[model samples]
Target: MSDTITWGMMLRKLPSIANAIPRLVKGMKVANVKDPTQTCGLGWSFEQATLRNPDGPALLQGEVVLTYSQVNQWANRMAHHLIAQGIGKGDVVAVFIENRPELLVTILAVAKVGAISALLNTAQTRDTLAHSLNLVAPAAIVVGEELVPTFSAVRERVAIEATRTWFIADQNTCKPPGIAPDGFINLMTACADGCADNPASSRQVFFDDPCFYLYTSGTTGLPKAGVFKHGRWMRSYVSFGMIALDMRPEDVIYCTLPLYHATGLCVCWGSAISGACGFAIRRKFSASQFWSDVRHYRATTIGYVGELCRYLVDQPPGAHDSQHGVKKMIGNGLRPGAWGEFKRRFGVNHICELYAASDGNIGFSNILNFDNTVGFSLMSWELAAYDHDSGAPTRDATGFMRKVAKGEEGLLLAKIDDKAPLDGYTDPQKTETVVLHDVFKKGDRYFNTGDLLRNIGFGHARFVDRLGDTYRWKGENVSTTEVENTLLKHPTISEAVAYGVEIENTNGRAGMAAITPAESLATLDFSELLAFARQQLPAYAVPLFLRVKVKMETTGTFKYQKTRLKDEAFDPGKTGDDPIYAWLPGTDTYVRVTEQLLAQIQGGKYRY
Candidate 1:
């Protein structure tokens, strides 16, 4: 091989470097102009986009194509309608809807009137749904017509008044049913006659005002609502939209992730608004139809989570796999092993791996398109040595947290101050649990991310693992305590311990539970238990593997011991006499984990 490069090769690289300069300049301008005092909210961004490109396409949902001005007007109409019902600044409006155009529109409408939109996760049921709705104490709630039955089932438990409960029609029916359910008014009919003028109240919303609340599973059985301030959304718009992805006005973004998540709501949608781009959305992700949808919409950019990427990668190879127009992707949790293969197979030009929590103050992005890294961080952050067993920061002799050396894994923490303050959760007491004081210096504070990461050099880091009682699965965070509480609710389940176990070829860990039955194993109605789990928790949180334990192990304090159970995992070979049952996909009941089934799992036959 020649040591020196040819002149032609050097000349070819010049155009590549030249093409990035304009984007660099635009990104710099966006960063410099991101002012907290400049009324930087989603509503402000919506107005600016409408003014800049009123005729440009904004939203694409199946047969519908809404322009910027049309979407703005729709939001305005909804805002006026909501204001007529006494919803205004400082008020909270609950939104319980699936991923639809109205979901984002309702959020914007709530923001336009200086009201906080509490985005309820659609996966919740009954008591969990009621807890989330009651947590915010909303002045009103907007429910999708398809979800009306679920909302109606828990209406009595929720505190929203009958007059304030509004129902938006689903895709199947643009109008509410002729006979509306009691205590629910049809929002479409009510807002059809409302004014389309922009509400003046949006001007009162400042940078620090709460804009949205996203649910995150807590240490308890219920989900804790995380505050998402307008200021933070503005930052993401500048950093992720303008800088990292460097989107343009003509770009069309395809987002299949749920809108309730920050990755979809703040990063994906904010990027579209910042660059006046178009968005093609889906109600939910489908691996089989992902590329087809991308091609149908002519999407130049796509959003994903690790699980979605794995699902797409697991599908059998076909001509359509590489036939889509996706040039760039922006998301978190793209596993290191799958990174190169995903890009190579899908022909993605850029992969901007990002890392940030809904309530955390700091974040990282792959601005330089680095491989196997979460890229650079602009804010002050550190990798402090942590206790893996206890899931706590390791203190040095001087009573200060020690930073891990480069390339070593440690706990990720963000310095908290006036500029990088943790927005925290709706429960202030729960907020206090995640904040650590005197971390490195006297009287200093840091926001604990509860995640482990490697301190890769050059300001970049690699995500290692999640700590404490929380584990991520299927792109959603699962709390061990929450699942355990639900499992114990069954009369036949006397003891239950929940933990996550690594599957051979999965994006995140799969949940598993070790339980001691109250009676003979044959007497236990596993199908009924599965039904109970499906009712009490989201599908992702339900344990996939169940170990029938002879007796439950406990610590000196009587706390359930998950260490030994986690070590043994779900492997029947290592579990000794204890039998393991697995909830196979598409199956109604639990089946014994036979050697053949274990081999199938190890060989990656099941696309779990």
Candidate 2:
């Protein structure tokens, strides 16, 4: 009722008007388009950059380099073959292959035909492989010859009536399994013979159409398939590739991550958006060969995950460590402890650390050269505190959603309106679970990203930990990342994972730590790490129990999943042969957790 306009009122109005102007103009342009069908999908982008740039390198694998024109021609040939084999629009084709030229070619072929390509994680075991294939119900499956054993194991469990199954081998060979009555084809032969006689199918495709389905870790439960629409894929190309990295058509991108993951598929493929070349690595990441490969391929840019960076930093400093042609690096999950060290050792000029999930609608990139922070978003989104136990947002007294204060950790949510569609998945039930409606404003929708992040000013955010990775200790919230960072500072520790375990009569959960010691520090003085952690972390945050592992289990994407480790806890009796240690409050070092000690602790006879 005051004459003076409050700052909050003025700020709110300004943002809405600011966001609408450009969007309104874009909407009008699209509405007035003379040919609406031509203004859709990757076809538009492909047409903009024709085959005149054919001589430019588009892909590099080892010593081989395929030009942009060659890549497009190969994809077109493959697409024609697929169409002849009864695989066209609306069909789901599962591709099980490693990082190779064939993988990229297959994905492009699938997209060209307006089909949904399900890129299956090659690292998945038989059970997970079966689950993934069953969920997709692909009309056809394309696999590498090396993964024949994997498909053989899960073939009985697959329910889809696949029309064709193909394998790419060293030599063009059609060796179909006995049970596969649909017949087998060889990729080499298929590409050799172009489908010139078959006419192109006439099907309606839109920007909102599903191009690919990327599966996320089922850490909460079972893995859910996340659909990536053509429009969202195009957006990644513009935002991350063009605007963020400012990549040029001549840039050579070194991609070591698996092609099945979203980071490699979207960011790496975004190089193609500018007609840039992508160098693919097939084998597991080797620190010794990392710089050599970069130098050999003359890669100007590289993509990485946190573990990849940590592994490189853990290696002994070589004479050529600082000698590399890599000018920029992009990807997510780079921990704060290794950020500066990685850049200094590798001599990388630009570290575009981005934060996004395979299923997440919201994304953040380091556009402003912010250190240890994921940069701001150009779209609409919100962050709110989420209940870990219930996996939902917390509501206030008036049933209104609460937003997290700046610098506080919260679950990221993206506004899903008509403009920003949440083309979730084929499974509607799984999709509904991630969408929240009528939160801050009535009739508004938001996509819940189950990640905990701290807003680090200037529209930047730093990923703190996964919601499940965080634990309550001594009535205070303890982030696993905070503990992991402190442990990494310990000279003896090589890798570490910190989680919480329920203890008898405990207020909430007690801290537990797992570590893999450096080889040189095998005979490490345990007192040093214990004393260091005690000085660095609070009393409640310091781990009460410890487990030493020679190697830690990680997902294909190199993310450490603590669920199984948390379930194993610190019971020495059940730990098989791995060493377990326990810390007594006043002790300067940790002592072995013997069977008798574990029994006593579980029986409530021992207190620490």
Candidate 3:
């Protein structure tokens, strides 16, 4: 990608630049939070939004439309109910609900009570789900009726009392009373009797308090609870909403991403709230109907992931692709290859791509409407030389890390200081695992982002790849351990190692596993293994390709030689004695991947 800023691109961005100046000027004033302990938090922000436009459209889902007053009043009632239940500041409340109006209201209510909302991933089940719930030790849990069955399967594994289990009916509850199954309290009915006035706790809550515990995939294969504070929320409220997007009251943001994730909850929804604009949502994303929903909501901006863009671009051309009203977009993981196709085909003007981790201290915004870059960070950041073989940073003769030259891929690190603190994770040890000390000078500290980036000109950088064992696929980070753990449960598999390999036209890596059969390769049932894998793991986490080998190669430390496996990939020619197999998209069984089939798959014949 060219690092130079062309005059034609500048001229094309003239109108957007003109409109963004006022928003950026106004946003920078409130974006500064020198003293987080002294500033108000989420409750204050939401209340201010309600006060801004009481009757303006706040949320739209399906045929339902809620005003700012309606949502605030609903959340206020729930907040009062929470206080009655002995829940208050610093308490953790596990919110086990899918993407819906109830999920947002539950979190907002928890915010008003000054409690941390532990947003549970809906795709998780069995052991993974139990680990996340027990990690936080929530004071209470609010479950949507849709997820009650899934939660009930593992309720016995948690420590919460039956009475403390709150449930919101799946059906719309216009009436005061709603139905709930046994061992579940109807949260809506109980809260309906409470006062609908905003609580005094809103002002009492400060920026340092925890607002949400969003999960990120851990190297150990389990999810880690990343602490997201109100102070960071202030950054998102300003950076994406006020500075980058600059949305108006009439603008509606159509977000189809999951609410439990940072990009959807904090960035997209927070930006909508910052402008007091309409926030439209759906339970799940469907590429086929994406344009129809955008048109129906009249969304001016849309939330997207890299894979989402690829899916849309993969669809057959249609008039709605370029006929929609969407003019702007805000999200991350949009690949450079599909960026132009998505923008040109959809008629979007500005792609306000953002870069930030739920647990890290650094953030970047595309404020100047730049292409193929994360833009720039407001705080101190460094791109240091990395040792790819050992997966560590390189040290110079002085025993200090060296900075990678401009236009080179290097590991990204952020300074940890009072100005920009690393919020870290629920587990202190896990948080400490990411910290690097004495990088440049003695006693100096930095947070390792575990990401490689190439520094372009103009203080901007382009994202390169994620380091270590974990790789992202289907917009979700796939842990090698997680996939390997699930693979071990198969009777025929004695050993397994998982890694991601790049496909020809795909945005991110595709999951592949090298396995050793317990008996002979002919004795193993590929169909049975595929069935077992699909049952044990999420669809995205399941390995797409399988390589059968008699002996698994390892390093001197007994670690699987994943680098070799990744380089060999699923190509049968590369694996001399070992045979390779592939589970094609929409297929139930694995088939032998020969040279001819590999060429056909890579030549755009298959839609994987």
User: Top model by TM-score, which number?
Assistant: 2
RMSD of 2: 5.8
* Local lDDT at 259 for model 1: 88
Between candidates 1 and 2, name the one with more favorable TM-score.
2
lDDT of 2 by residue, 1-608 (tens): 12223355446647544654554454334322234264444534443343446577777777777776666667777788888788878899999987777788778778778889998888886888899888988999888877878787888788654447787773222121222223456665766668522124323456677889998865555677889877777667666776677666667788788888888888766645544545456456777788888888877888889888999899898888888778888988888888888888879977889987777676778765556878677667778977765547898887868999987779888898655568787699989988888889888889887778777664667787877788887768889999999998887889999999987765678899889887743666778778888899998899988888888888877877688778889987667777888887667888898888887777777564
Candidate 2 clashing pairs, residues 3+ apart or interchain? 365-375
Cα shift from native, residue 82, model 1 (Å) = 1.3
Worst 10 residues of 1 by lDDT: 1-10
Question: What digit string (tens of lDDT, one per residue) describes model 1 on residues 448-512?
Answer: 99888777665777776667656778988676756875786687876677898999978778999
* Residue-by-residue lDDT tens digits, candidate 3, 333-353: 776766777788889998988
What is the Cα-based lDDT of residue 299 in candidate 2? 78
Write down the TM-score of every candidate: 0.76, 0.89, 0.79
Q: Each candidate's lDDT (Cα)?
A: 0.81, 0.75, 0.85
